[model samples]
Target: MDRAALPGGVLTGLWQRARLVERRIETPTAVTLVLAPAEWPGHLAGQHADIRLTADDGYTAVRSYSMSAPVRDGLVEFTIQRVHDGEVSMYLCDDLPIGADVELRGPIGGWFVWRETETRPVLLVAGGSGIVPLQAMIRQRRAANSDVPFRVLYSVRTPEDVIYGDELADSADGVETTILYTRTAPAGSGRPPGRITQADLKTHGWTPGFDASCFICGPTGFVETAAKALVAMGHDSHRIKTERFG
Candidate 1:
């Protein structure tokens, strides 16, 4: 996944607006947008793009959003969470309409991507909307028919705030998943309702000798805490990769 070559001619065509081809409401707080570039350039899963828009007063705002669609998919999909007081998110969620056009540059970012050749077992940890990039990775792996073992530990404020809840649950039927709810109990199920901790990891059979490569993406503090916990459990730092969202 070469970041420099991504976006191709689209990078030079920033002044031109890319049309929104599709949109889906993922949850009360998030929406997924599918954009078709006037000219489509390939993008890798787990990579992100920069969307820029100019207001009537000539004020320009830009934001980076991770690609939600699998890399093999031709269109670009962005799963965006609405952020209160965020200039770009507010406009995208409240104002952007179907068939609207916006300036975008990328298929950028490399560090977050899992290249196709990677076959090691993967452990993904995400919080809230941070699951976007990891979703891409999971889809990529499934698309490739790769036999890699992968699992996800997704923490959210509550069941209501769990983005991609149904999809993730269905996907977990074939892959492992541990949902941690910080503000709500595990509804109906007898599973313990609490934040992730060392005991939770141990109970889930996550141990040092699993030969798994860990990828953690979430709010900065949660990611740091999870990483430290994994490290304390004797997982190699080199085997752990992380992306933090503020």
Candidate 2:
């Protein structure tokens, strides 16, 4: 898309060279890469970048990854989860070295973003690495010192699968996170291991009458289930935004 058609009018379709400045391991299967694009006009919290990688034989692959944090000194961060047998993810998670250069085009997507001016209570639901963009939202909230209330329900297979574990635990005021273990519950856990049910939303999410703005991101099946549950509980479908990856 052209710049006029791009979200926020801050991105272009042309791919720019970006260099990896930092890398951090988020989980066994995920890694966070900080890249400094030659030029960046800034982006919304929930936007993403299309990363292009080329091989020695001239084969190229492109994939989209949500930003895990807000822009800092023109640097952008992406937390990528390695998909089994997936070339792009595997390379990004394991082989992409610091100081290497890659092609990036984005700050793409607009509908799923969160703005600081919003006053409605926010409900964020994420499954697995879907928490990346939502984490950017939380960081933006803190950075802007906006007191918008936020409630997060994060689903993972086990404790080790939770990304940004320490940061989520130490969230600022007006933010809260509830972790739901789908396959393994930790010791002394009161709840049994299970998928997120309507009951879970009712307990951890805003009341239907609160008119909260809901953002759900995850695998396709998980996102669908959560959206359906929220709708069944009377949340306006328009107020519930979703971003899914598989």
Candidate 3:
């Protein structure tokens, strides 16, 4: 039997009615939803799923959200930032109740994924909610017992705005993690409070000699700026992979 065709519920309906099984508060303004498949289907880390919701009037809104859980897990998670006017986000954050059925189709997109075969040193740059996919990569790498050196530079408006702060800190036990807070002052040693600049990368040990593979995710402006900087630093443009959100 094809794994894809297994009784995972109607692909279209499982794509539609996978309810919000759990929710957790990340930051004051952010929430993470754990969606369980009416029937389980595995997903790959670093991939995203499309979530759709129907209105009482039969209208629907759709949005793509990156999965935060490790691929092997039966449950899928999405860390969402509430956007005032965003239809899906607003629904997920406010109106969607625990156990309320929701629609999703996913384990989608392969371009941004990291697999065991990728042996090069990695450098991840993310801003705001863009850290979602990088979180998956971090978990997958750790699970595979991979020794590949990797680093992440996460930029946020303030310390409070940093998503997965505790998880990222714990994950940094061996891997490098740098947090740049643009709106707040640096709390103590090693924390840089400002927007990401070329100098910030240098201070974080991003050297031209590293020959690293770069993965950048964020808003259009953030991705463009980070990619250009990495390219100017002599990193091969072909080795840089980017996923821009909005």
Candidate 4:
């Protein structure tokens, strides 16, 4: 069920004024917003926030977006991928002005989040903008100065579609990052463009025997395919967590 359709009392209590303090262009179609909320209860790495936009005509649209970075002071940040014909996303990525305010409620989703105290190895598989939350986990790991082993497998249509490309390149210090271009591989690339498969997971992902915690996020189809591949690679289903969006 859409949270917006629920009884107002259920969500109203969590909504607070969030002012857009900073904006960044992530890709041609994506934008990142840094907001300062009137109040915030710190959030876990993979959690998300719900933003509500109401027009003068009383029409309202609400959408959930994953946090892109760990909280710094009283600020929180999330990236918006402009969805064609998306009421909320289009406004957020193209029209929302700096210093403008929106009703924000979050620190949502506890099951898929990653905590700094976790010591086990982590396997992060992302498809397209699904990297948002996984990126948060990576940032949090660095912020906490954790040495936990992390391996990231990111699948995108092309190099141009990769989000946080520069930062991901710099994440090689302790994190092993691999980009698998599904449609257009860059020149001189060793692997041809293709969908993620069991071989890909076995070669790049943590071994099933390592007892790694796996987080997979993407569109429904992509998430399902990746999760299935992991299970086929002998990973315990219980150790896998997934968060998917359209």
Candidates in order have lDDT scores of: 0.75, 0.88, 0.76, 0.87
Expressed as tens digits, the lDDT of each residue in 57-109 for candidate 4 is 99988887888999999999998788888888889888999999999986677
Model 3 clash pairs? Answer: 13-16, 15-104, 16-103
Q: What TM-score would you give candidate 4 relative to the actual structure?
A: 0.94
Ranking the candidates on lDDT from highest down gives 2, 4, 3, 1
Per-model tally of clashing residue pairs: 0, 0, 3, 0
> What's model 3's TM-score?
0.88
- Off-target runs (Cα >4 Å) in candidate 4 are 1-13
Candidate number with greatest lDDT? 2
Mind giving the per-residue lDDT tens digits that candidate 2 earns over 1-246?
A: 001122343454679999999999988988999999999878898988788989999999888788888899999899988888888888888888899999999878878899999999999999888899999999999999999999999999999998999988976587999999999999987889999999999999998899999999888899999999999999999999988876
**How far out, in Å, is residue 157 in model 1?**
0.9
User: TM-scores of the models, in the given order?
Assistant: 0.88, 0.94, 0.88, 0.94
Query: 228, model 1: CA deviation in Å?
Result: 0.2
lDDT accuracy of residue 194 in candidate 4: 97
After TM-score superposition, the amount by which residue 169's alpha carbon in candidate 3 deviates from its true location, in angstroms, is: 1.4
User: The CA-based lDDT of model 1 is what?
Assistant: 0.75
